[model samples]
Target chain A: MIPTISVFEHSPDRGQGLARDMSVRWAFEEVGQAYEVRQVSLSAIKQPAHQALHPFGQIPTYEEGDLALFESGAIVLHIAEHHVGLLPADPNGRARAIMWMFAALSTVEPPIVQREIAMYMEHDKTWYEKRLPLLEDGIRVRLHQLSSRLGKADWLEEAFSAGDLMMVQVLRRLKTSSVLGEFPNLCAYITRGEARPAFKRAYDAQLAAFIGKPPKQAN
Target chain B: MIPTISVFEHSPDRGQGLARDMSVRWAFEEVGQAYEVRQVSLSAIKQPAHQALHPFGQIPTYEEGDLALFESGAIVLHIAEHHVGLLPADPNGRARAIMWMFAALSTVEPPIVQREIAMYMEHDKTWYEKRLPLLEDGIRVRLHQLSSRLGKADWLEEAFSAGDLMMVQVLRRLKTSSVLGEFPNLCAYITRGEARPAFKRAYDAQLAAFIGKPPKQAN
Candidate 1:
């Protein structure tokens, strides 16, 4: 049976693809998996029913048969593990890919998320100006290290795996910020990941869902 | 040859077990894996040598043979993947377990970490009081959903896996707050996880490392 994942009925981003479900959709499309999306409203997400699917009342949650899963990273990993395209076949390489996945979520994403919180919620606070640079510096440290490691390589690791998929998604959050441009290679890498046919499909699909239309085919 | 993992030479947490390396130490102890800890000071962490292993200069990078990996979640997953006890044999069940691992880091840990930042760094801010509750409520929502699903179950799933291991660690951050007590089942569940011999061994080992002494055996 095709699995169903939850997404926002009307995204807060207004079709910007910042919604967390975009990653899951992209993963599914990359793996060529057919799935359904159950659009959830903001109020319904906090209710018990939605909470059962997602402990945090967040999108997206994956359900198939008796199996239910939350956390986009987990959902993506599940898709990657079950499907052929997302991971490497070599044991060590596979483990490294998984490591990159964690690095994206745990190390890299935290600072970027912090920056978002500061921007959206704490903009008026007295400490906002003081704290913004600290957060950005933290993000820059990670990005600098990532860029150096990535060097001239197209991806973070050997080939494009789930790790690259996740890292690209995390880096995309910095697209509007000057932090990304600080590292030229990393910026190009993000563009490369974005240029993927599957990613284009996923991005367009999420954008379509937000705007209430069907996804446009990539040119 | 025995594998080696990276850790802080002198942790900023001052042995509070807040450092990321604690999780790696705990995971190693859980599997009875004999490993060595290579200490990296904050300065050295930023140096090229350390950057080679961990692009972000974070602790708890793992190396076995020629393979080097970073990110505590990824390192723990790697250790769990190679060992028998951390993951289940069933494909779907294994996927669920991995999902929980991601949920712990991505979904559950973020709010708690935010609360920490607000309390510690932003305490003097005028909006601290107003913002603190939002973050706490965010955390509480996740805990509530988790508790309801747990529903008197001993573990998050049927058997104790790496998912539980990571979840328990993440939830432990909320111990000082009464937030966890708001949900009885989750409190009991964390207690059960803490009472495990493997967990106890790991905890004590970490505590010992911090205290600069051997681990004490619990009665």
Candidate 2:
């Protein structure tokens, strides 16, 4: 049975694939799994029905028969666990890959999101200019640590598993800011992730959601 | 061989068990796993050897035989996956339990941490007074949604799994603030989690680390 995922009806990111659903969609694409999407609006998301599926009433919920799940990280992990391509076969390697997923969502993304919240919502505040640099500093620290770890490696671990998929998505958020550019290896890493055929397919599908058309195939 | 976990030599949260290691410790107690603790000072964590085990250089990191993992959420999830008491045997129940772990870390905890950052680091900033309310509102929204879902239920799901463990820990952070008090059910829910023998054992273990004593055993 094809799983259905919930995404934003009108993505606030303007189809740049920055929405949480993009990661889940990318995971599905990476595993060559066919799935459906159910678009939910900002207003409707707060309703009881949507809240039932997701306690936080957020997007990118995975519904497969009796199983209902939210939190993009969990949904992506679910897809990766059920499929072959997104995770390695070895138990140790698989556990390490899952660790990266948590690291991406919990550690890396928090500072980035804080920066975003400050920029988007607090720009007019008195502390905007003063606080912006502090947030950026936090992001730079993470990026530098990540860049140091990546070095010349193609992926975080051995192969391009879901760990890289999640880390790349988290890093992509920094593209609008100049923070990501500070680390050349990190920038190239994002470029490499985007170059994957599966990522292209996922990106196109999300972009197409905005235009009300079928998703374009990857070249 | 017993697993070893690295924790803060001097935890930033003092002996309150707010440290990430508390969750890992709680998971071990719930699963009845006896683990050794390796205390790492903040400076030591940044060193090359520790950084190899944890790229982010944070605790608690789990090391069992050849398998080493970081990210508190990942480590807790790893403990839950391997043990019978932490995760349900059924796949759907397991997926939902995992979802709450992500929700606890990603969805619910971010605003709470942002609020903490504001209070601790940005207290003297000009916009602290103004921005403080916004952060509280963000936290309130999450608590409200979570409270609604958890209404009249013993746990988030059918059983008390790792999901509740992670959520309860996240909520415990708000005990210092009055925010958690606003939700009565949520407050009681936290009380229930704290009343658990396993939770007491874990909490005492963490507190004992601060006083250089052995952890109190569960009755």
Candidate 3:
């Protein structure tokens, strides 16, 4: 049976492909896999059924037969592990690739997400101006380190793997921020990732949701 | 040669084991593996050598043979994959275990880290009082969801896998928070994890660093 994944009924990201579901969709597209989507309303996500599939009550979650998994990183990883294209064939290469995934999620994404939270919730607070710069500086520190590491390299490592897939997507969250343009190589790196056929397929597919022109389901 | 993982030369967490390296040490103990430590100071980590080992220039980077990896989640995962005790043998169960790891790191850890950042960097700001509640509430939402999912379960799954290992460590960050006292089941869950012999060994090993009673190396 084909696997099914959950997505927002109406993403707060406005189909900018910023929704976590986009990563899972991108993963599937990269692997040339066809899957089903289960659109979940925000209120419905907190309900028992969705909670059973996802303990945290978030999207996107993956389910194939008896296996139900949550967290976009895990979902993307599940796709990468099961598929041939998204991971390196060598053991060490594969481990390095997975390490980059953790780096993207655990290390890089947190500050960006925090900045968004501050901007969204605390924008009107008195400390907004004071705090915003610190948050941006936090992002800058990570980006500088990442920029140094990514210097003159196409992918993070030897070839494009799930690591690049994760890192590129994480970095994309900073698209709205002015700091991303400060690093030209990183910008080019993201450009390279976006130029990929799989990324285009994924981006367009998610964008289609907002435009009311979602691609036809494979099922 | 045995692997060597990096740790802070002088950890801000002192001997509390809140350091990310604690998780790696705990994983090593859980798997009954021998590994060395390379203490990295705040200034030293910013240097080229350490940056080469870890792009983000953070502590708890693993160096085994030609492979060097960073990110506590990735390091713990590497240990879990190489060693049998930390993961279930079955594929589906293994995936579920890993899914929990992502949940802990991606979904659960962000807010906790944000709260800590606020307390550390923004406590002097005017909005500290105003913003603190929201950060704690963010954590509360995740904890409530987790508590409901956990209920009275001894572990997240049938057996304690890396997922539980990660989730347990992530939750430990809130030990000082008043909010944690509100969830009895989650508290007990952490207690069960800390009660493990492996955890005790790891705790003592890190605690030894602050007390200058470092454990003798196995190698």
Per-residue lDDT of model 2, residues B1-219, tens digit only: 788999888899999999999999999999998898999999999999999888887888899999999999999998888888989999999988999999999999999999998899899988889888999999999999999999999999999999999999999999988888899999999999999999999999889988778654333
For candidate 3, the per-residue lDDT at B204 reads 86
- lDDT digits (tens) for residues A133-190 of candidate 2: 9999999989988999999998999999999999999999999998888899999999
lDDT of 3 by residue, A84-124 (tens): 98889988898999999999999999999989988898888
Q: How big is the positional error of residue B186 in model 2, measured in Å on the Cα after superposition? A: 0.8
lDDT winner, 2 or 3: 2
Tens digit of per-residue lDDT, candidate 3, span B4-60: 999888889988999999999999999889989888889999999999998898888
Which sequence of candidate numbers ranks them by lDDT, best first? 2, 3, 1
Q: What residue pairs are clashing in model 3?
A: none
Model 2 bad stretches (over 4 Å) = A215-219, B215-219
lDDT of model number 2: 0.91
Q: Where in model 1 is the C-alpha error above 4 Å? A: A124-130, A214-219, B118-120, B123-134, B214-219
Q: Considering lDDT, which of the candidate structures 1 and 2 is the better prediction for this target?
A: 2
* Each prediction's DockQ against the real complex: 0.69, 0.85, 0.88
Q: Give lDDT tens digits, candidate 1, residues B138-212.
A: 888778767777787888788998889888888888888888889988888878978888777767666676667
Q: In angstroms, how far off is B35's CA in candidate 3?
A: 0.8
Clashing pairs for model 1 are none
